[model samples]
Target: MRAVMNAILNVVLPVFGIMLAGYLVGRARILGEDSGRALNGFVYYVALPALFFGSMADVPLARIFNWPLILSFGGGLLVTFLFSIAVALVFFRGRFGEVSMHGLTAIFSNTGYMGVPLLQIAFGQQGVLAAVITTVITAVVVIGIGVILLETDRHQGSAPRVIARNVSLGLAKNPLILSALAGILYSWSGLPLPQPVATFMELTGNAAAPAALFAIGLFMVGKSLTEGMREVVWISSLKLLVAPLVTAWLAYSVLGMQGVDAKAAIIQAALPTGALMFVLAQQYGVYVQRATSVILVSTVLSVLTLSALFVLLGVQ
Candidate 1:
């Protein structure tokens, strides 16, 4: 009992404590209203790209070759995404693009912001491969599909050729995806990044978590909670409950994963929705309010659930 409480306090405190500081800063009006935009821009264009590149660049090619782990992680996310899409399409009866956004909120774990740190605390360096594998999967596959779907919908009625060209450009230009690709290529090539260059990336990447949380807090100020409570509840439930369960099953039964690898995958799956989803919501202008609610609610609930999971992992 004490261990679980410590786990919850230790893990959840630092992450959300920064967020709480950000929230207070927002409430205090220190940076003014548009500061959120500046912060978001930093994270989106600068911090996140640096973070992805540095992390992927350092990963061993051998780690990249772990087919079972990669497949299992990607499979878990894919199943959750498909399930979320199905639920949205059936019940919400929305346009396919909008439905895809809904599904994205349910499936996109806050792995970069929350999961990596949690894994580090629990599993040490063993967690690195699992975290990087899932982050790569999340960066490449999850966000990639969401961008394609939403971009196609956004450019509706354009010439087919124009839409195709635009979507190609959009994916190529997305900083998150492009940076991850560059890092993977660099790692594969086994090239050495210069010391100064590597240090710059390390510093920039380090700023991502705190800056993101602060920006989220600033962004949340004055946002109404009343508009999308029902949608928020459903998506949060899907993210917090269903996604992890599905991930655990896939890792165990399908991938034959056991011990720390299995736990790493499951805990990551259980993280709250990524703040990057909010950036996407802003970019695409789909489900913005509901996405906000999902992030707020899911982050809060993850404390209890994650604490329990930590205790469970410790016992095992």
Candidate 2:
């Protein structure tokens, strides 16, 4: 119980507190709307890449190659996607497009922004690296395969071109994928970073999480909580509950995984559906409100869900 309390206080509370501060700042108009956009852009373009590159550059490639951990995570996503689709089809029979959008939103996760940091706090650096790889998988699949799944129009384009463009574009700009590539190149080259450059990246990278959480908090303040609640409940359940359970079973039973690897996979599975869903909705003019609602609510609830997961995994 004491250990559990410590995890909540040391790991979870600090994260949420920073997020709350960001939320308050946004609400009070200190940072204002443009500031919020700038903040997100800074984190996305600058800080996240630094963090990813820094973490990966030093870690051994072998540590990031835990097949059980990778398979467990990837498998959980596949299962969750299938389950979400089934539920959508059964419950939302007519609204295939909207239901599919909600389903996709329910299963994917912001493994980069939230999952990696929280896992690092609870587990360690190795967990962070593993989670980073998970983020890579998330970006590639969710951006490409997910988009393909949600696309209902046959006249949208040639399927091959659509997929190729998505995959190409996703690989180009995503910090996680680029970082992975950079880290791998650095590792293969066997070159160490210059002291000044290393220190600079480290300093900037550390700022990413707090800023991100704050942005999330502020974004939450402006949302229509009441209107979004119904979708939130449904989407959050699929993300926080169903996804993790499936991941746990796969990790423990199917893969015989134990220790930190298993824990990381489970927690990643439970992460709030990625905010990318909302972005994609806006890009494609899909169910934008429902996607945003799921992202918001799932993130709020993940504080509780993740804390409990930490306790379950004996994080101390």
Candidate 3:
């Protein structure tokens, strides 16, 4: 019980506080509506990529190449993706675009921004390394496969050029994937980063998580939560509970993952849906409100869910 309490206070509270602060700032008009977008861009384009590169650069290729661990994590994520689609088909019925929006929200997680920091705090540097690999997977699947599913119009005629262009652009600009690839190349080349450059990246990388949480808080402050409660709860459950359980089962049984690898896979699987879902919905003119609500609610609830996971996995 004491350990649980400590986890709540030390781990959960700080994250919630950062998000809460972001909410307050937005509500108070300390920053305009666009502030959230600005902060999100900064985190995505700058801080998160740096953190991923810095963390992965130092890790050996072997640690990042755990087939069982990757399988468990990827399988859990894909299962949740399919589950979200199934749920959307049933509940959403004719609302195909909204269904796609929810599917994206329910499946992908902020593994780079939030996952890296939370794992590091809970389990240390080794955990952060594991999370970097998860981040790479996320960047690939969510932007690649996930987007393809969401954009495919069964009714409208397919534009192969548009699809190809989008996929190509996604690959080119995906910072997390690029960082992982860069790390791998660097390792293969047996090149070491200069001390000053590495130190600079290290400092900035360490600040990414807390800043992201705070930005979340500020971003959500003024938004009315009344519009999307039903979809929000259902998707949040799928993300926090169903995904993790499926991933845990697969990690232990099918994949035969154990020890730290098993724990890390479960942890990544349970992360809240990524905020990128909302950005995507906004871009494509889908159920933007529904996606926004899911991101907000799931992130908040993940505190309890993640703490429970720590206890169950005996992280302490």
Candidate 4:
């Protein structure tokens, strides 16, 4: 009991507290309207890439290639994604681009921003590695699929070669994927980073967690829950509940994963819908309102869900 309490207090409270602070700051207009955008840009372009690179650079290539972890988490994510797509099609009668966005909102966990910080607090470096792996899975496999579907839908009359080229270029431009790949290559090389370079990465990467969380809070400032109540509830339920359950079943029953690896996978799975979902929706002009609602509702609900999960997993 004491351990559970400690885990919630130590791990969960601080993470949410920072987010709350960001929310307050944004609400009050303390940092001006552009603060959130600037912070998010910094985290995405600089901090997160540095963090991914640094985290992967020193780890052994063998340890990084945890197939069971990949299979369990990726499998669960795909299942949730497909289920969401079915719901969107059968119930909402959504178009192809809209259905794709619905699936994305269901499966895209905020692993880069929330998971990394939360797992690092609870499980340390091992936790970070788990986060990196899942982030890669989400970024490369899930987002890649969503982008391709959206592009195909938008450019139905265009040649396949054009759509493929566009998707390829977009994925290649993602700094997170590029940095993770670079780190893996560095790990494969088995060369140590010089002191200056290592120090720079550490300094930059350490800023990712707090800045990312704060940016989330700031981003939520003007979003309202007044629109799309039914869809919001449905999407939020899939993200906050169904995704984690599927992941837990796969990690424990199917894959036989145990310890921090399994726990991290489940926790990342349970995270709120990624903010990137909203960005994608805005970019494609599909499922925009529901995306906002899911991100907002899931994030608020995740406080209780994640705390309960920490206690259940004996995180302390």
Tens-digit lDDT string for candidate 1 (31-107): 87788778878888998889888888888777876676666667777888888788777777677677888888988
TM-score-wise, the better of 2 and 3 is 3
For every candidate structure, what is the RMSD over all alpha carbons to the true structure, in angstroms? 2.2, 4.4, 3.7, 3.7
The prediction achieving the highest TM-score against the true structure is: 1
Error of 3 at 125 (Å): 6.5
Candidate 2, residues 146-220: lDDT per residue as tens digits?
555545432236587775676566556556557656866786677887888789778997887677666666666
Stretches of candidate 2 exceeding 4 Å from the true structure: 89-170, 173-176, 271-296, 299-316
For 170-270, candidate 3 gives per-residue lDDT tens digits of 65666656765676677666678889878877887766676655565664665677686887899899989988899999999888777877898898888
Q: State model 1's lDDT.
A: 0.79
TM-score of each: 0.90, 0.73, 0.79, 0.78
Clashing residue pair totals per candidate (backbone < 3 A): 0, 1, 7, 0
lDDT of 4 at 3: 46
TM-score of 2: 0.73
lDDT of each: 0.79, 0.72, 0.72, 0.79
